[model samples]
Target: MSFVVAVDGPSGSGKSSTARGVADRLGFAYLDTGAMYRAVTWALLQRGVDTADAAAVAATVGEVRIDSGTDPLAPTIAADGIDVAGPIRSDEVVRHVSPVSAVPQVRTRLVDLQRRVIVGTDAPGIVVEGRDIGTVVATDAPLKVFLVADPQARAERRAAEEGGSDTAATAASLQRRDRIDSTRAASPLAKADDAVEIDSTHLSLDEVIGRIVSLVEERR
Candidate 1:
């Protein structure tokens, strides 16, 4: 049986990295849903749409197309035929993505697209990570994991990974993202009731991956 894993977590949590690592070890496809939202947000920003206007924001959903690879090691995304693989993760997109993603129309479009990717892919299964994967997009996924960490540890980890910012600012940024993501109207960041919550604050990356592997094997 194909094993789809739904991983959901708040900003600065180790969801992205841990999901990618788990996918690599299990030979499963990795779906970065956050990048998709960021890419769409970037497209709307490029077009000069007012960030606060829901109708305006939703109008551009058709113009932006997100394409990602199934490979765990290689991640990619594009917006409006433009290769935004790198820029989507920039500070600009990061700041506004929550507002854009919060729009009802925007979420509707992206969620449909995400479902297509998960169902259409040839990979045996996909490990999807985002704010609402377990709650919305892949609710029926057999393996659901909600990764979390202390706010301080999350900030430190984010700061260390980001090459362009100081730890203090990175911490502040993550705090802002957490507020935005959790407060958004559409499929806000939440842990599923059945999801296994893992506190990765003090755990090593290997430890996290091993735990997920154990979960997967048990399911198998």
Candidate 2:
């Protein structure tokens, strides 16, 4: 039986860590849907596609081939057989991902690919994390979690992860991403009605992971 655990949250909300932790504890494969978008964004930028032009992005979508690894401990993303795992996470790609991902066609193509990845998994199940996994990609998932944190807390966490990057700048960037992701036309970031909401503003990573693990166990 496929026991999918869908995790959704805004940037810096600990979606990736908590989801990976849960998948590791349960021995399920992990999928970071956001990386798929980042990979496509990286490819578009590499090809000099104008990210602001939705039509141009949509037209170029098929030209990029994105493949993601499902291991929670070593999740990977490659574009067209090139190991772009490092390049896709650059600040430039981060800035352009929102615009490229906002394109309806891009979302459609990626969503379908995401589903295929989950279905092809041979593990007990999969834990999929993204802004819209619960709301759009896996609405029928047996377990869904929506993680949130105080904006300040999220900013601090993200800054620390980025090698003590500017807290103020990171906070502003995260809030900006939240606005764009939440307002986008295609598969906007949202919490599913059936999902359990976890405010990690004060909770440690283990605490958040534990809470979701209990939920998964109960649902299973």
Candidate 3:
């Protein structure tokens, strides 16, 4: 049986880096569920669909094929056979992903895909990270971590990730995304009651990864 680890958190909370690190340390498969949503958003934009229109998004979501490679060292995502690891991170997709992800049909479809990936992992386990992983995607995961960081810290981290983008604007955009994601009608961003909450504001990436890795060891 795969020992699943569900890492849930808001944007820039270090869920991606921490989860990937944990997976690498343990030789586990890793899945970034957020990228699946971003891939869908990128597909919608490419198809000229208005992502803000719920109906349009729902109607068109199934037509997009999203593939997520699980290798921790070189994870990749593709939308309709097109490599989108880079495109999904573009500013346009980031701006529109929350809305596209809020569509019930979109969540329903992607959550099913995410579960399949988790269950089919050839490794002994998988570390899956996203807003809803602990609560919705893998409630039965052996270890659930809800990562958090102060808004300012998150903004700085995101700015660094974006190659020194304006921190103020990034902070504003993160806040906007937080409001949308937490209020979305579908699987909203929230901490699962049983999750271990880690405040990453002052924690080094190595420290965070080490903590989660220790938890996984304990659980095993």
- lDDT, candidate 1, 1-220, per-residue tens: 4688888887778888888999999889999998898888888888898877888887767877778776789877777778898888788888788789889888888889988889987877789989888899988889899999998888888877777368788888888888888888788888899999999999999999999989998987
Q: 1 or 3: which has the higher TM-score?
A: 3
- Alpha carbon lDDT of each predicted model: 0.85, 0.93, 0.95
Residue 214 CA error for candidate 2 (Å)?
0.7
RMSD of 3: 0.6
**Sort by lDDT, best first: what order?**
3, 2, 1
Per-residue lDDT over 1-220 for candidate 2, one digit per residue giving the tens place of the 0 to 100 score: 5899999999999988999999999999999999999999999998999999999999999999999999999988999999888998789999999999999999999999999998999999899999889888988999988999999999999998888999999999998999999999999999999999999998999999999989988888
Candidate maximizing lDDT: 3
lDDT for 216 in candidate 1 is 90
Give per-residue lDDT, candidate 3, residue 76: 93
lDDT-better candidate, 1 vs 3: 3
**How far out, in Å, is residue 41 in model 3?**
0.6
Q: Residue 62 lDDT in model 2?
A: 92
Candidate 1 residue 210 C-alpha distance from true site, Å:
0.8
TM-score of 2: 0.98
